[model samples]
Target: MIGRYIWEISELRRSHHGLTLNELNERWERSSLYDGREIIRKTWYSHREQIASQLGIIIECDKRTNRYYIAYEDTIGRPDIQNWLLNSFAVGNMLMQGKDLKGRISYERIPSGYDYLTDIIEAMRENRIISISYQSYWKDEPSEFELMPYALKVFKQRWYLVGANVAFEGIRIYGLDRIKNIEITQQKFKMPKSFDVEELFEPYYGVSLVDGEVEKVRIKVYDNQAKYFRSLKLHESQEEIKTTPEYSIFEYHIKPTFEFEQELLSHGESVEVLEPAYLRERIKKRLEWSLEHYK
Candidate 1:
């Protein structure tokens, strides 16, 4: 019930320019989730506080207009934490309302790793170390190690942990799904003041890091595929360098990592690597190998 209220209030405030207390209550009463009574002033204030504290969203009232509006509308975090939380709850609310439509509405199932999220997040919050027995796809056996949990990221429906291996020199990323077991340690460590997760992963696509420099990569996306690229960029550094009726040339300053190569290959022949001879050659060789399988 509380989740529904939060989602309703957040959605209402987001859609409108501003709303007065009476105006908000009126809309709430009209909502399908509305109970018998209207939201009293005290309850509304409590909800506002909960929303701000729990979701990092603030509902502020305009002193002059006497209207309430959501502050920090456009400044959501890089990972879009606010939207992610709200959207997740919104989906839950929808599921509750439309339980009969379960078969009709499909969702991409996240394979594994969500079970470890809470523990990892707790470790990250306290700046504590985590010991995990991890199974790597490349290795035959599981390896145990202690890691200083720094951040968690999701890509392609899989959760990944970015942390420092206490016994190793550089930072490492481990897929949560690959973790066989995990435990939070009593020992704590200081998170480096200079460490920024976004900055660390900015030059690469996905969580996979490669032994290469950030190079200027350009790709020509042909026909309708260019529209998809424009709507949802492949990378933050992506920019449309040139455009014509037939195709659009997009540029990025990123490492041509293995994950990135796979993403380009997923687009099939719609995308062609135009710059960086090495990356183009690599892609060409990959396509040749793929073709050989068909032959």
Candidate 2:
């Protein structure tokens, strides 16, 4: 409820008029929120205001209208701030519910499974380069890589760090789970002011940015599989190319990396790569390889 309250206050600040208790209650009544607490009391409002103030969300009550208005600069734009508020709200809500979260929800994500998150984030925030000992599945042993931490992204329930590796003099992606140890460097580096993470990764699907040519990948999903693909888009660049009774063709303008192929193959025999001859052959070879294993 606190998260919702923070969100509500931030949103209400966009308007000239503030939100009154009656208006707020109307919203709460329509949704499952706090025990429907009457926040009209001065003390209740003051207490919440204090918490919001700490987060840089200034709140003021108008004497004439008897309503609450968000007065401070917006803190909602910052992901770090939002994350803190979300954690605070979730913990507060769980306490209010007086129930353990066992089976209540399945996060199914292990982003927090690693211990170096704080260290990496701190390095990124401070514009400090970091050295990490990483072991990749494809590699025989752990290797040391000095990376300028740029941004972190989550793909398929795993956390990945995207940055420039000073050691290799190239940009690379590292899986947090594979990270053995991280050392924050004393030498500071300048992150390009024009660096845009989204643009850097626009050509790739998922976290794997293969040092290969980008392609317009087309997949032909047969029958029921097409519906599932439509609901859960294969990629942001996914587009319906053509549909026929036998199959429906969808296209994604992306880097058809190993991860992308794995995702397609995971859908079993329902999907077929059609546009690129290489991807099609790759998939065929994989299926043949699977048969050989069984034989």
Candidate 3:
């Protein structure tokens, strides 16, 4: 019931711009989840506190307009994990209310590794180590190891754990789907003060880190394909260096890793690597290899 109210209050504030206590209550009274009793100011304040603490959403008042609104609206959208959490709850709440329309709604099924998320998150929070039996795609058998959990990332509807292997000296990314079994340990490890997950990943395109120098890379995206790159950037360093009626040239300071090359290849003929002659040659070779298969 409280979960439903949280979603309602959040949705109301997000869509309406802002609302006063009375304005909020008026809408709540008419809401589908509303009970016979009216929500007093005390209860409303309690709900506000719960929303902030549980969802990391802040409801602050605009003193000039005397209306309540969601704070850090721009910042909230920046973190993908936080956004996913809020969206999950909001969707669950909506699904509960619309039980009759069960078959009407469709969702993408994310593959395995969900079972390990809670344990991994707890381990990360407590700064403890985790034991995992992982099955790598290239390997024939599962291997057990202990990891100092650092951070979690979701990309392309898949979850990945970025952590340090206790027996090894460097950080590595593990796909959750590949984890056969996992257990959290009571033993704690201090996360490195110098380690910044964002900084670590800033130079790459995907979760897989490749060993290479970051180069000044440019790609020419043609026709309608330019709109997709414009709306959804290929990389954070992406900048429109040149524009024409037929195409647009986007530049980036990135490592042309295997994942990055695959991404560029996904665009096929629509994208052409302009600079970094080696990367261009690499892409050309891959395309030629692909062409041979078709022929």
Candidate 4:
């Protein structure tokens, strides 16, 4: 509760408020941080440090004035960490308020029926190749493939493994749920010295097919959704070049992929493909074809 309360105060207004043991008691109201009337100094800071370390974030306090603030920047884009912290805070809040969210709270839904997460992680850690029995939805039967597991990512609530397929030249992404069996090989492989996870996935959205030249893709987000784009960017390359009360124009430098196109389509009528005329035409044709199905 001390950590959660302190984080909230620091986040809303940093220097304007200096939080001390008394202020924490006033906020949390008769928590474990105090012994009835006195603030327990050692235990309070110990809990704060524990929460900060777990979240991989820093919360700074000035001893001279006892004011607290978050010293870290660049927190907006990381949905995973943000979701975790928000859930943690919610649970703490409910407990302190003498209420249980229980049925009122629905957890983030992760697609089930995948079991190869640990095996792939260990293979990546050991720099070893793994043989997997994978059955893609498009195929009739399961196929065996050996892959040098590089990185694992969670997208749309499903886990995916990205690495070099032995039969394929470049890295390929395989869905973990589609993988039936995992056999870690004794064979060791060297990860390329220049293979950076971020750089590899930077030009694409979600798990990509890894085709085509990278383009400075641009799009126009109309109506209320523009505010959401400003807060949670579509990609690291996303830039908001124009804005008005009616609409906002966003530019992105991304390799056009099925995943990226589908993402844009999800926003529906609120979004339009603005630049890269070819991409705009592609979306227009797709929408026309979609309308045909209803007819």
Per-model RMSD to reference: 2.6, 5.6, 3.1, 5.6
lDDT per residue (tens digit) for residues 1-295 in model 1: 5765665555554666788888887877865667778878898888888877766777888899888877756444544666676676667666665666668887777667888998998899899999999999999999999999988888887889999999998889999999999999999999999888878888999998777678999999999999999999999999998999999999999987789999999999899999899889999999999899999
Highest-scoring model, TM-score? 1
Predicted structure with the largest lDDT when compared to the true one:
1
TM-score of 2: 0.71
Better of 2 and 4 by lDDT: 2
Judge candidate 3 against the unseen true structure and give its global Cα lDDT, from 0 to 1.
Answer: 0.84
For candidate 4, list the clashing residue pairs, or say none: none
- Which candidate would rank higher by TM-score, 1 or 4? 1
Ten consecutive residues with minimal summed lDDT in candidate 2? 92-101
Greater-TM-score candidate between 3 and 4 = 3
lDDT of each: 0.84, 0.75, 0.84, 0.74
Indicate whether candidate 2 or candidate 3 has the larger lDDT. Answer: 3
What is the full ranking by lDDT, best candidate first?
A: 1, 3, 2, 4
- Cα-lDDT of candidate 2: 0.75
> In candidate 3, which residue pairs get closer than 3 Å at backbone N, Cα or C atoms, i.e. clash?
none
TM-score of 4: 0.70
Q: Any idea what lDDT model 1 has?
A: 0.84
For model 4, residues 42-139, the per-residue Cα lDDT tens digits are 76677567656554445567788775555444453365555555665656555544434456665666654457777787798799999889889999
